[model samples]
Target: MKSLRACVAALAIATLGVLASPAAPAQAYPSPGIECYTIIDSNGNPQIHCIAVGALQEIDWCKGCPWAISFKDDIVFPETFDIDVIQGVENLSLAAAAADPRVAARFHDAAIADFASAARGLGKQTASPGPVGVYDTAHRKFVADNQSWLAAAGQDLADGLALLQKSFGSRDSAALVKAATAEFDEAFKEISGKQVIGG
Candidate 1:
């Protein structure tokens, strides 16, 4: 979604550049008279434009100027409106997420619980493995201070799912789960090393 907004903004800037760009010296020679006219811009504002007045045959070619552009369609960015709507929805979600730390904490806890539940299949096909280690004191403090969600959730979620494939319904499941923590030790370290950020 962010990329989509960026592309739209870039396209709009390019279009403005096009409209503002001077069409290369339309008239090679001076004309006998000057023609002046007023045009309504995309903004519904009046724009005054004057051009060399001459007969179609008398003039070789009269490339339009930005002040008096004669393009078939007006410059318009319909996507901007869509982006505005999307941003409104995004703003609401962002505000809700930042309202408190409960959401982030819950999400982290849920992911760990999933790991703990599936961790017993490490060594044996039907054998139970050891308990999953809890977050250390430092990691718990780091998380409490963060009051935020991790943008890295996507990768973490993927890792957890991959761990499941190793531990669940596999030979020596306990070993497989242990090997996956993403091995538990690494997850513990990750939580401790994770950074705290402010909104």
Candidate 2:
């Protein structure tokens, strides 16, 4: 799942280097606005792959900027018979909170509500590997071993949400942003250590 970070980085590199082609005959660009795929695994089970390469497109739109970029290979496709991972599960909650108008407007009560929702989502077990696979044994063990750290990081995220509530109630946008950023930093640290998977 963390490999999505690599995908994002690759998307950035490709966007920076490539120039638009005109013969494709598209408005603004020739790239597809969205990309999705459906494929079958080795076990004959069907799987769908959809990558939100435009995850940050909302932010860009909010800032009055429309960046045309291709989002190819945005979703992970398993070539081997390994467990399929859900990438960016952890950050999705935070991204939702950050996108909330309450957080942007600095509304204390609404901010609390939005942040609490995100916190709750973050507190749950977000990563679970597939059940039947050759790598399942090791993957299961890896998940079991990292449970403690994952729980700790979840707690940190929840605590950070509480801090945001307090800061917002005090009407301190600077403090709120700083505290939220710090909480993210702490959560990153908690996950990036010896036991965690993604940094």
Candidate 3:
């Protein structure tokens, strides 16, 4: 019994040591199949970046400036391509999802989280209507470089999402799912054509 008690004491101390240890560092944005592209900032300083996204989320620039890009056929794109085809129907309307509180809550929370994350993932920026910040130069160059693709892709994504939202608002599950799937396919193809110019 004394030995057992001593063992317990040892275990407690071990546990305490583990608890006191520093936490693992936060993960940086991954770039498995990504490529870094550079652009000159307003101050003529070079800015390099890669896009990042989480599952079931839209693509956006990474939070911090990391310095590597290696593509493995999984290049990120700026569209709501991560929405599930069948499950995304819940986003149609709050009233429509009232019967399934779980679905409603899941989508609601996810929407909130995605919105916040997208804002952060867009990288640091000053008030757009006012004076520009450091990152603005890179952003401007990115916009100019991919002007045509951005316009086309942005319009297509907007139209597709609007159609999906409208179908949901009408409580048309069939249309909702159809629109989501179509948008998924189109976004895949549209984004695949995007390129990061090395400026």
lDDT of each: 0.28, 0.32, 0.29
What pairs collide in candidate 1?
121-173, 121-174, 122-173, 122-174, 122-175, 123-174, 123-175, 180-183, 181-184
Question: Ranking by lDDT, best first?
Answer: 2, 3, 1
Best by lDDT: 2
lDDT of 2 by residue, 29-118 (tens): 233222222223334343333322222212221222111111122334334311111122223322322334444334333334444444
TM-score of 3: 0.30
- Backbone clashes per model, in order? 9, 0, 3
* Prediction 1 TM-score vs. true: 0.23
Evaluation by TM-score, superior candidate among 1 and 3: 3
Mark the 10 consecutive residues where model 3 has the least summed lDDT. 3-12
Model 1: per-residue Cα lDDT over 20-63, one tens digit each? 22233332222222322333333433333332212111111222
Q: What digit string (tens of lDDT, one per residue) describes model 3 on residues 47-155?
A: 3332221111112352322211111122231232222211222232221223345654665445433333322332332111111111223343221123333334334
For model 1, what is the C-alpha lDDT against the true structure?
0.28
Best candidate (score: TM-score): 3
